[model samples]
Target chain A: MIDEIVAAPGAGRALLDDYLARYAPGARARGMVLEQVLVAPPVWLDDQSNTLTIRWSLANAGAWWGMRAVSGADSAVAAWWAEVDARAISRRRSFATAPEAIVRLCDV
Target chain B: MFRLTQLVTLADRAARDDLAAALRAVGRRARSLLVEPTLEGSFNGGDLLVHASFNAAGDRAAFELEAQALLGRPATASIDSVSYSSEADGREPGLRDGIYRVLLLSIEPGTDRDTVARFEAELLAMPRHIAAIRNWRLSRVEQAAGARAWTHVWEQEFADAGGLLDAYMLHPYHWAHIDRWFDPECPERIVDARLCHSFCRVDRSAISSGG
Candidate 1:
């Protein structure tokens, strides 16, 4: 199962590409279907919000570090990410988490 | 004495778990070489949990001291900090973060420039350290922008084109403070090499914790 998924390099990238193509034109469509495909299998999906958080404690340290990614269902996951960059660049939105820095690349 | 932490981003959750489990199944024999945790869990948020101790060694005084405090030392030991973006759970508006925890302890008469330099050299020469940082940086750049943007700006500049950024780039906020880290001889090279090695140790610890 893992091998099959890993073998398909462009599949994940393509799914993301399709989401962008569909939503970039202001489709305002439900993005859940696309979200389910692009991110679900690879990530451990958290249904309530379609967002994932990774957390870990510093070795022997009391502090915990976390990173998060979220998307809207009506928009392509890639579209959501695109908008994130747009917003960050436009100063409309600020990244509260560091992980978003890398997650935004999924659209490329 | 100074310590370094290292971290590696697993390509996928299963890969992360598989590596962790593989490390754990090997048991005490492996534990003797490094520090690792005992409990493990993967959060609904897409990150994995690990609790382990560092392997005991004669020259491991620094690690042991910091481990007692459970605090990461700054500068000399806490050499590198990098982030990675992984596939999201799809319900949130942010990317999931994968962190490998590596704690370095400082021991003895204290760390000096020359000592750190030697350590930096040894650490960077290790293959595992280079591989982990390369993957982590790639994942980070991707999350910062779309794949195309990252490819054009980061990956293409570093990995694909073999540009100067290939070995080192400071975190935006840390650039100023990073300046004070090393002597003038080869700041960029040394810092990059040091950080890469530190991150590899963190990655190794995370894998060990899972098992």
Candidate 2:
């Protein structure tokens, strides 16, 4: 679940929120801040290849600090970058998948 | 997340008896007691008459008797109020919808017989209750409709936890229940089993009953 969640766009918000909720004092000391939440539609680059993308941003130093405090600096940096890419990819995929999911939901 | 209720199947008499017993045992030892009745009404999908409660030591004695009678478990029991709740009641009832059966308990860590037993029991009972309600026959279609009306009620009293405040403002009962079952920290647990199998079997039921 954590893996998939991190792979999700706007996952940074969730992760940041969780960190603050569980470790607000540590978050404050680190300058963790959540700048925004972005949910993108599923994208389908091609019917054959089938790719996805998502996009999001953050404004607070705490966002990075929060990640470092919770996951450690090295892993935190990796997680932050992962969130950035995942958000963009998820958005692209959502645009591609939304119609299908909605159709499936309705048809089923 | 997909509603877990979709996987439920009705429990037989023997099963219900066993579940009742288990519920009764736990109810007997709770610290506080609260009963949320599942009124037979129509709203969300239709109402599923559920008598959920929280009971601490004061009400534990009676709760234990009832829950044990409902589920058949005999382990050391302790609990708080039963947060009795039902689907919303406003719309008409129908035969196409499913009902809900919920079981929430917080046993002391390391004290429970099998951590997942009670959780599974409650999860399994939902279908049984739905099946029982569906089996009842009413002579007149309208009369039967009316009879089914209160069986499942739908209400939107539950708040949506989206933004930060939304998460913070969640009712303590809801959070407590979630924490007990879903929280990563606590080994203690609460189980809520819902079944929408009926809805899929038939067409869309009235949404007035709480879904």
Candidate 3:
């Protein structure tokens, strides 16, 4: 899964930091592994904000379901995201898999 | 007559069974009550499904106070409810023990009338696909008086709960064909993904009476 957050001007780093500090732990507990984090443009000058990208993944379909069930039961997970919505300009989470894995993934 | 259908998520996972048991005793508060845990098919199904009938609108306004303590704050993480004057097919609600299944959903905002009508027609035709639906009722919400203004309420009585969890879920028409309208990623999607698909034990018919 890929999470792309367009942060407000000068807010990208803080947004990324807050996500790591406040949301990552709960996500990790729910069996999602943090794959990578990136900031667009890499460097930020005055009045410039970066687009923060977070990549998270689960080992398998069962792990995916387990993570969802755990996260779904936690109201904190949703509350935290609602707060994130205010900090960022816009955010989207997209899920994808390799073409080779498509057939296997649909087995569920 | 007023019909209220609510799906409640518990702040505490342990609170599910207790809430179900508590709701069962409150049947006297409404003309009828069907409360139970959702078996599957939705993330928002919540811990309890509270389907009740009221003699008057004010009756529910009064009982919702008691419901606050039984289903509100502290114990609840979230709740979605709707109140409406129901529409029912005039079928006799034969007396027997059965499973009461309620599916509440909202069609995405801004869909065209033709598409919405087609979607509703397809959904109302489910009994033609699955024989297990012993009795059924499909109603458009007359009052959009819910946390979410659900567009439709599709309810059915099955001979057993397993019939719902198994047959209705696994049927070819349901999973392969009709599910496209409810699937968020599908191009044919109509209903929002946050649907309330829940069922509970019932000794009598919830369909014939609520309207």
Candidate 4:
């Protein structure tokens, strides 16, 4: 599965570029093509933790590559994918209603 | 040199990339154009962050008009003016690649004057206790003719997203000392805090170089 992480928008873009940059050599070495398919802003779910989550998608990559990246079994791609699962797990707790509550109280 | 930071909420998902591209195309007239998406926080009904700087205030206003036209009625824009910033020394370079948090706040009614003063003081003094903050600023909104909702704005730039998460969000000082002011239970909740992220534009050339 493709892993996702939330970041501030600019940082998210830089990260996406960085990820592609870092993965390009290894991917080319393996003769695989990696293309970023989508880079969109987060859909703020009331149940979501990050208010602005940048969702990134890549095309022409397989599950094996994703698994390797997530598992951190290989040091080369470990740094990039290691935090994917961690961020997803942390986002699971849900602070969805917090923003609404704050807005109600402060009226901003 | 004036920079206008507008916190905007997209009318729909479709407007995301279109608006970003439009802002970037504003071109040489703009010193810098940064479009940041809010990943994990919200304020002022905004999810998209648009920051643009210009050499002249007139150019900045012209850009705003163009931006509003592109954004259309579906989006709402709030412009903030820097009231106090540490970057006046000119030593600060362009925004670093990291997780930047922009906080919009309004002190609750009936809050003691001293408490408000202390809250602002401690907020500025946060770097002394937490080391992850790379740069930060506090600004007050330049209210237009109508009523303004948020009065104060606080911005913090972290070394990275993890640094923001660990050093600020989960810090002991933040939890023990800072969190209380914003406690929902307290009638004097210091302010309604709206958190958003700021990012540097991606370096496409570096990505292509595989660096």
Candidate 5:
């Protein structure tokens, strides 16, 4: 079961690419460089509450260059994020708390 | 002294549990070499969390090498070099066991150096206000060159999980003084996780009842 999940394709890179494609240029225009982006697999919390969590870590060239992707006038990245949020919410409601399903989404 | 905490996601429940057991056995045999060694499944079901403190950097490195060998793979690990420790004050460190909340943060680009220093100072002084904090340490990552690197680490050990959820997380001072740096509009990125474990070496009797 775990092997199947780990072998599945990940949406992280595609999603990150979309985000960068939409927002990276604006960030560069503002003199900030998006050094790196990392997305981890979905984690199932054993707190008995059936919480599923994901982690995304971003690194910028400097301290001032952060937050341009989700903030400011550009709404493209924000809109994309909202769609991801919606998907997560829907998943939470329908997810059977199955370990396999959790593992599948967490494949990063 | 330095501490290495590694968080890794395994493919299955069995593999995760197996690694935890192996770490526990290693801890049992190397009691003198490692302090408060811990291996447990993270509250998140599929991940394994390992934490061990060493009196010397060489010991810490050797342990990491051993752990990597045990796992048969390169694990995602964060090794924090302690830059400031309140335990160095000669007082019995109150934070030996309980729930540990760790925050790894990268500072925003172009932010004033002075502002970052002031923010750090406020964080170091948090125990002065919040009575629930048992042990608090803030350290800078010596190697911040990799994709997994974070600029600074803030670790606080509380009496229980409630101390984190009820007191520290909800504290007004934390929001007013510290939270802004992590705002989405700000220049910092943060990854935070909590671990529930006990320190084997801390003398609970020496810890003060008062904050």
Candidate 6:
């Protein structure tokens, strides 16, 4: 899962921390291990949103689906996002797989 | 030439293969027949599709009568059938040995004509972004007589199964743009959820060879 966050000038760091602190535990419990967290520009003052690209990984498609079912059933996972939605201007989450696994994962 | 296509929902899922075989036998009486069970990625699409073409226009009625009679043997739940000539035939020479996909959908009743036109234009524009759609046709259903009042019959022939399941379905234009009309969550959605999204493996061109 990747999150594109559009926020006020310097609030991205706090928002990122808030997400990591609040959502990370639930995410890990649901079978996702935070592989990496990187904020573009590290520090930007001009006119640009500091996009947070957080990535996670699982065992395989089976584990990913298992995580989805578990996460879906767990209300805290969605509740956390609902609580945090007000802080960001716009937030979007996307699920993707590595290009090498596309043929096998997407069943193309 | 007349092409008669029916998206059928069987009362019993176990009898699908047998019913498909029986339908294939009935379809053979026509010039060409493609009776095959649809693979996954189907929303409200039926169990299988009965796609048959006739050389003479009058043969359509006779074939339909026979096929309709056979429907009672297995106790079909419902069927959405369309008989139409290729209204917008784009039989480009890209892929002959490919799969044929057909989508039957009804525009939400009472949608403004301009919005519906835009929806169709956006739908037709899909091939521009996704080149895998080898042969395509977007036709207004001449006669939509079935469980639902279908308005449009959009079909595409891809170079291969991947060209459909992957390239066509996953393309950004399909989900990001064209999908809004089909997605119930989107406010721009105009299509009803009961859509017949069915496809079959066809080594030959189902649209071009219908005549």
- Calculate DockQ per candidate and list them: 0.01, 0.04, 0.03, 0.01, 0.03, 0.07
Each candidate's interface RMSD: 18.0, 17.3, 7.8, 18.9, 14.7, 7.2
lDDT digits (tens) for residues A42-98 of candidate 6: 785345567777877777645654675566456676566666566656666555666
TM-score of each: 0.20, 0.23, 0.60, 0.52, 0.50, 0.63
Please give, as one word, the docking class of candidate 2.
incorrect
Docking class of 4: incorrect
**Model 5 superposed RMSD (Cα):** 17.9
**C-alpha local distance difference test of each model:** 0.26, 0.28, 0.74, 0.49, 0.44, 0.74
User: Order of all candidates by TM-score, from best down to worst?
Assistant: 6, 3, 4, 5, 2, 1
Taking the tens digit of each residue's C-alpha lDDT, what string does model 4 give over A1-108? Answer: 122445443345554465567755665454334433344434333343432232222221233234323332345443444443333332211112234543332221
Q: What shift in Å separates residue A4 of candidate 4 from its native position after superposition?
A: 44
Model 6 residue pairs with clashes: none
Top candidate (DockQ): 6
Q: Which regions of candidate 1 are displaced past 4 Å?
A: A1-108, B1-13, B29-174, B180-189, B193-211
Docking class of 1: incorrect
Q: Candidate 1: interface RMSD in Å?
A: 18.0
Chain A TM-score for each candidate, in the given order?
Answer: 0.19, 0.23, 0.92, 0.39, 0.35, 0.82
Which residue runs of candidate 3 sit more than 4 Å off their true CA positions?
A1-108, B13-29, B40-43, B90-92, B142-148
Worst 10 residues of 4 chain B by lDDT: B202-211
Instruction: For candidate 5, write residues B46-136 as lDDT tens digits.
Output: 1554545556666666766677677654443323322211232112354454655555556655657787788788888777767677776
DockQ of candidate 6 against the true complex: 0.07
Mind listing the fnat for each candidate? 0.00, 0.00, 0.00, 0.00, 0.03, 0.03
User: What is candidate 2's lDDT per residue for A1-108, written digit by digit as tens?
Assistant: 011223343344444455345443443354533333332234322222222212222232224223333433234433543444444333111101234443332221
Better of 1 and 5 by lDDT: 5
Clashes of each: 54, 106, 0, 10, 11, 0
- Model 6 CA deviation exceeding 4 Å by range: A1-108, B13-18, B91-96
Candidate 3: what lDDT? Answer: 0.74
Give lDDT tens digits, candidate 6, residues B1-211: 6788898888998888887887777766587788878778664567887887787777888888878887864578888899887643554644466788999989989999999999888888887777778777787777897767888889888878888877786665664467667643234667876677888777677776652
